[model samples]
Target: MNLVTPPEHPFAQFVRILGKGKRGARNLSREEARDAMGMLLDGKVEESQLGAFLMLLRHKEESAEEMAGFTEAVRARLQTPAIAVDLDWPSYAGKKRHLPWFLLAAKALANSGVRILLHGGGAHTAGRLYSEQLLETLDIRLCRDWQQVEKALDQQQLAFIPLGDWMPPLQHMIDLRNILGLRSPIHSLARILNPLNARCGLQSIFHPGYQAVHREASQLLGDTAVVIKGEGGEIEINPDASSHLYGTANGVNWDEEWPALAAMRHVKPASLIPEHLLACWRGEASDAYGQLAIISTMALALRGLGEPRDTAINRAEALWASRHQVART
Candidate 1:
């Protein structure tokens, strides 16, 4: 007869560090958080302790140290091949009000020879249409693995990988939303992971208050990024609303506000159709609102990638005007 020995709970100590009440509980230092997250990604922690540890981090806001450490651990677990990427665009936010205008912008940039790596997850929240849902409509395939991501980029300069494929533990953590009835820290960590360590990263928040925290955390990760209070918390700029962009530009911190390109219009469209994005890209759709949204978002991305503001704007406009998706095909 053989007896099964229980696995040691390696994460219990870190959980205790954060779970103790006011006097005893303290935030994990970068190193401690790194160790804990490493254990999490390595499958070293038990399920019960994992839930407790996640909630504890969520209860008290995640610090810059924690975010940095967690991301560092994630990168360590990934065996990413050497892939040159011009931009890291992450989209986990689902859009209820509008089609993803940013998708068009990303493709347009790719059309202009920019290599973009778009990664995201879906349905952390129920009832909203996420980015992955629009792939078929856009004629872009969802990369099932890292090799596919590289191949897609090589063939078209644009590729999208879901978070579930990029990192399974993160996907599992994000899935806990349905279980815990609240978002765990992975939601924040997923957004900030520029897996390729790209030169430019794009992020946004729904709540205006988290703007500062996201900005500072991006800085802490030592990855160049641009953060904004984007439409429905996505990186798509609302052409009708002024967008304040916060991040490191040219290795220097920047806080710049881009004024609205059009007047406020509160009327929601009758439908949210993904095909319109394809139409807009192919010059078959004449939506003033949609076009402005795409151009402004592309301009923001170019700026984050080190283009001067004026040059970014001019190039973005030119890229928009010269779009020939239909003509090329």
Candidate 2:
């Protein structure tokens, strides 16, 4: 296969370079990865070729430089809304067993004067579903257009952008992973991709193994991101008082169980599933999980946005109390 021919277009060139690889995995140089990603975001690569490139990248695994380069390429294609605060939260893409709290976290942060943007979908084959479904239950509509996303932030200080709506090609790449019956490199890359020039970000991680990757990538990217090993990959700390909750920014770090704040008590766990939780929100049924999700997520959001430990605990208690009364009535 010829790797040096200049095709008629950048995308075609990308297809030629990436398609030259065999069916199995292959390591990619930083330049190759960047060129391929640039072609992808520029709409230069054909759909089939793009799918092949993604699969190849998955089997090979992405290095920090490659991931960073790919992220830059993707961001160039994004139409970011002009919000007062450049806040971002990347959902880790798999959360079926436990309840989702990121939606609640976004809402609570928005309520407390923080500008927030959340991105995710509902096509997890193994997991129960994504966070998009939970937001729908809260009456928060997904913004389809980048302009509308900006407008939502300008007007309401909160916006949710489904990957399908914001970037179809990238979503197509993610969908291809489903064909393999497991997650692909895109899954990990998506968690670290911050499209907007957001100075503050709340990033969630699923497995502990990815902590070094996230930390290294965040450091290299030099963004102010708080990495959380939240519940089921959502940005909520475990309420058992046993799990260690950590947040890091600019080399400074803090945890919920630090010696300075060891007096905090664990919140009670919720017992309902995602669908039933929504029903409970609508007053059509009772959902312990929904209520717990709201409380725990709100607390974590407060902490993520720089709220003092005591204040976060107090705010969570107050919000839970208010919601409980409403549910009773």
Candidate 3:
């Protein structure tokens, strides 16, 4: 009997294509990226290949085409329910310096009748407060599956799906942070994965160049999205600093600069208390920084929904003022 050697693994081509050399390496085309990500998500790739592929992409700083393709692959694998969702909120970047005030903004929007879908990779990074851990405290439903997501949306107008529940492989990649010593491209791709096909996608990026990449990728996917350099990399605007908004509207891309909410910078809290979110909502506490963050974040969402800048600010303020009535209803 003669022994025969197997051919190269199909996934190896992608890794090779990316790792060829500094001059030879190039970003994957949309189709190739889709195929590569599909293999990764399906667990068809080898363990070594997964690490190599991720780090290669990380080194190259994934292009808009690559991100759009990765997002396409993830969305294809998603079992999204037929729910009317107005916004797709991806909160993978956990908050460290500030409390996740964006959660309150999202809740208020849901209360005002905007159906939203929020998703995140759980608390993979230590010393950070993830939305997954605080959803229950905020009274937002954390759904485990499509059925639960549908029900939550029908009842609460908002639902949060943890990445582990929808796509375990991506969550696993995020969890490899400590071992890898650097975050993989999953963090970037997850933000653009609007699995539910919502009308608007809100994404936050902390790194300097990623905002444009996210904005362009969403445009490539024909998604109306808003990208902001939010507080602590979560999708909450800092009241003390001006925010630049990169977004797509009606197939056209646009950029805008939002003035800071406060005339002067305010000191950050020494520690974050989750209950403050609930207390503020219940009118039991008043925090200027937190309140401005919520209102400004809501304004960004409203702008993504086609409201003019000034109108969005005004509407956000009105919504914040009337939140108690909306919460009761």
Please, what is the whole-model Cα lDDT of each candidate in the order they appear?
A: 0.84, 0.64, 0.90
- Better-scoring candidate (lDDT), 2 or 3: 3
Q: In model 3, how large is the Cα lDDT of residue 219?
A: 91
lDDT of candidate 1 over 1-329, digit per residue (tens): 99999975667789889989999999999999899999989898888888999999989888878888998899888889999998999888888887788988888888888888988877778767788888888866689888998898888888989999879888998888888888887877788899987778898877656777777777877778888888887889998889898887445688888999887764667878777888887778778888888899999999988887779989999998876542231
Which has the higher TM-score value, candidate number 1 or candidate number 3? 3
Model 3 lDDT-worst window of ten:
320-329
Residues 231-302, model 2: lDDT tens digits: 677666555434445556676655555221224444434443666655554457754545555666666666
Q: Which is better, 1 or 3, measured by lDDT?
A: 3
Which sequence of candidate numbers ranks them by lDDT, best first?
Answer: 3, 1, 2
Off by over 4 Å in 2: 1-32, 46-52, 92-94, 241-248, 251-293, 308-311, 319-329
Give the root-mean-square deviation of each candidate in angstroms.
3.3, 5.9, 1.6
Q: What is the TM-score of each candidate against the true structure?
A: 0.92, 0.74, 0.96
- Compared with the true structure, the alpha-carbon lDDT of candidate 1 equals 0.84
Off by more than 4 A, model 3: 1-6, 327-329
Q: lDDT, candidate 1, residue 315?
A: 92
Better of 2 and 3 by TM-score: 3
Name the Cα RMSD for model 3. 1.6
